[model samples]
Target: MDIVSHLNDRLLFAVPKKGRLYQQCVDLLKGADIKFNRSNRLDIALCTNLPIALVFLPAADIPRFVGEGRVSLGITGQDQVAEAGISVDEVCNLGFGSCKLQVEVPDQGQFTDPRQLIGKSIVTSFTNLATDYFRKLEAEETNGVGADEQTQSSKPLKTTIKYVGGSVEASCALGIADAVVDLVESGETMRAAGLKAIATIFETSAVLIASQHPTHKDLLELIVNRIKGVIAAGKYVLCNYNCPRSKLDSVLKITPGRRAPTISPLEEDDWVAVSSMVEKKRIAEVMDQLRNKGAEDILVFSISNCRV
Candidate 1:
């Protein structure tokens, strides 16, 4: 804090400019009560409530910005950190934008696993990440990178890299690259591209990255902590239902919250109103479960903020 604030630089943060991840960054900021007016240029958005300017860049470029100290903080995918080979520590993981990095080849290809890729060429936007994964896997027999595995890596990462801008999966049978390294949500696109995932590199999700040399660490972390709280509180609904004393334990299992349920005696001496939170996605199922357990008069409500 002392070192960062003494530098007297305007804090800069980078965000995914445009993509599925861009909207998520915006929603997360807003949920944290961070306000900004578009003013004139939409690309260079500002946070009106804090001493910060948020520059929206391609999601892939965020790690570089933070690494170069051009920006002090960034919201980006974890995959970007490895791809950029940057000097930034992942300070926090913001729980949205989850995806996986995987290797895919034509569904009918002879390749069944990574070992089959020994003499093959691969195309990917993420060359560094793929190289690291394979290099490490090849190290298993030696306990870790010893002389033999070093020779294997030096023998030319047989997997060639092509700078295909998009649709790396479709390049397989099309013959641009032998295999493709790309992000997968459900593997539906890989199948549609006539490919199947042969190996999983890593599970990727959105994260907050910070430079090793930040000029405003306090302000940078204050914003990050608030955004994390917002993410923690998302996707839950507060619910209350009345149930007979005999069925109280069953209803509790259906709608458990951060703490024990709040209970109150109802006008009917044998009944009590039980209040708790049910996850938004599980509401329907929980209600049915509660009803089957003798819960009556169920009420669901939304919560705007929850710190814990």
Candidate 2:
């Protein structure tokens, strides 16, 4: 165990403090019924029943923390992790904060492929990713000189990077840059700025990152299990209904669930109260199907946490 980690048995966890990803992390925890009861102004969160110290940091800094082992765990986007070249292993894909990192250009431009960019300059905030992409695209199957000679070879593919504060979509229209490498969520901003994506560089989502360093194995396992439970619970809903013996088979077929449905006798001898979990978004559809098969007193409730 590292001296630092050994000194602090409490796991250090980092989360994004602002932006879309931060809200998602909070919503996921709230949906799991995990309360954060720290001072309103404080950036640190303490899990009610866990020994973990949560620090809210800038989203872009999360990878650095996880990679350096300053924090034992982190919740941030996959793009940031890759960009930072972090080696932390992913523990979970939270399934939110979905977006695409792409190379986009002005709608009027006819440049569709990398070959056309051989002599052109590309502007982007993701300097590393952009440089890597263009380097490979400019490179060819043949040897450096042979390929460069055989290719257009008119001018070297020059990539100049410029970091704008925000709103990269407008860069193309304003003539501040040729093309932009940025996150495209709904393409609203892109369309508004008369920009169209020419190439998708990467698809990103929120991921849970865990440190590779040694630590309290038991505590780490407990924390992991609890977090997983919270995630599973958010994806499922508890549903219960009464059905006659004749319709039990039909009801079971509709609510087969992740494992098996719990069936118990009701006060009425001919009926049974069967309970199971249905996917959260599909609860209504499943309930309707069960109702059509003679299910009565149908009830749906959110599951707070689950462990398997």
Candidate 3:
């Protein structure tokens, strides 16, 4: 089904077509078992496993589709949502594509403080956020510098914000902008471009956003819960092992789950089987501790999806 056909019947889900957040959103849907097949060059695809239609759009436009109620849900970066400046409900964070919106200056420039570039030009794709940041800073500076003749010399230090579609870092080198407000994932890109960040405006990550006027509430909640389950499973694992009853207390300390772990008597009188959920990152360390405490047959298994 296409976007035009799904306006009233099916839920339209907008995802990034190509960008840092594109593959992440694709993987999230795949992990949730929401399979989709599409014809070549088609912008819309119907999910084979769910009552959802996927619309491949530019990352910057996903928030607009959601806010305008053209789509039921969307997955895009928080920076995109902030730039769109729309009234949409943020359902959840998808936990990938994390980066910081930062203010960067040329390497040789002696910019030390955000206030130092008050009257300078800043270029960014996130024009809304950049404009708001400077407007607030200007207000604070104006209020703090009140009733002082010398300070009044710098009375209205407004930043000139210019919006660019891409290659924002080049604006500084090209002499079009004195500084830039852009996203920095590793800072390697900025450094290679001969720039350095002076101040971080905000951090952003991939987020699940929904239209404030959702047409399908039940399906929307189901999809959100399924995605949440997949995210939870990715971060945790089920750990099971046998430990002597005498060492249960020590082992429990290592794998104490959301609630107390399950402890059941084994065939042997003094041995017990323990099961618990452990964070994926800490599974190795927890197993080591369990082994040190005389646990045996320790197993770590992946969870496909989980509610808790």
> Relative to the true structure, how large is the alpha-carbon lDDT of every model?
0.79, 0.77, 0.87
TM-score of predicted model 3? 0.89
lDDT of 3 by residue, 249-270 (tens): 8889899987889999999999
- Scored by TM-score, the top model is 3
TM of each candidate vs. truth: 0.79, 0.78, 0.89
How many backbone clashes can be found in candidate 3? Answer: 0
For model 3 the local lDDT of residue 192 reads: 87
Question: How accurate locally is residue 14 in candidate 2, as Cα lDDT from 0 to 100?
Answer: 85
Candidate scoring better on lDDT of 1 and 3: 3
Residue 294 lDDT, candidate 1, scale 0-100: 92
Which residue pairs of candidate 1 clash?
Answer: none
Instruction: Put down candidate 2 lDDT per residue, 1-308, tens digits, no spaces.
Output: 12234326567778899888978787766654556565676677676656666788988888888788658778899988887786988988887888998988888898776556555556665666776566656666334533554353454446665676578777877777778888999999888888888888889999988888735567667667777788778789999999899899888999998899899998998989999989888988898898888999999988877895
Cα lDDT of model 1 by residue, 1-308, tens digit: 23344224568888898876989898887888878765454556556777777778899989988999668888999888878888898988887789888988888878898767755677888888888776665554335545466566665554456667677877877777888889999878888998888888988889988888887778877877787667656777888989999888777877777677899998998899998877788889998898899999888988777665
Quote the lDDT for 273 in model 1: 94
